[model samples]
Target: ASNAYGNSVGRLVRLAVIILFIYAGLLGLTGLGFKIVPGGFLPTQDRGYAIVFAQLPDASSLDRTQAVVDKISKIAHETPGILNTVEFAGFNLFGG
Candidate 1:
């Protein structure tokens, strides 16, 4: 078995060509599989909460930010299918 394997490896040109063809075929099949599959890798799931970020200019005052946040919260509460909303002014979850 070792001798046969060695002989096959000795044919570097043929082995390289065969390997390249196999790799290309596998890649083509992967592309085809993606085209045939629907809805992508992860299906959308509804988690019960949503976050709204109201961003103002860099030099904007806290009062301005608070007013914007309040308006957004009010609008969200008026919209259907939204249970509740929580607002934070002069604070960032990602930044902090």
Candidate 2:
């Protein structure tokens, strides 16, 4: 009789452990399952302004990069509200 009681108590303990794990899993699912943020901050197509691309001649060497820099600087000087200017050259063209 005592052995039967022990067996029944062990079964009940295992069932309780499984039930606790299932409940914890459900709580975690509820915490992480829903979407709060929308897809994008801005529209994909509605650009406020146009982007201008200027490519230098392929014969451009290290020295010729200065001419490209000068041209870009002149453009920056002519344009208003130029927040930033960046130049890419040589290996960085492939790197970036």
Candidate 2 Cα misplacement greater than 4 A, ranges? 34-96
Which run of 10 residues does model 1 get worst, by summed lDDT?
39-48
Residue 2 displacement in candidate 2 (angstroms): 1.1
Q: Candidate 1, residues 1-96: lDDT per residue as tens digits?
A: 999888888898788999999999999999998888775555556476787787788989999999999999999999998998888999977894
lDDT of 1: 0.87
Candidate 2 lDDT, 5-96, residue by residue in tens:
99999999999999999999998887675454344766666554534455566767866776666687678757886666665444343433
Q: Summing lDDT over every window of 10 consecutive residues in candidate 2, give the lowest-scoring window.
A: 87-96
Q: What is the lDDT of candidate 2?
A: 0.69
Best by lDDT: 1
lDDT of each: 0.87, 0.69
Candidate with top TM-score is 1
TM-scores of the candidates are 0.50, 0.35
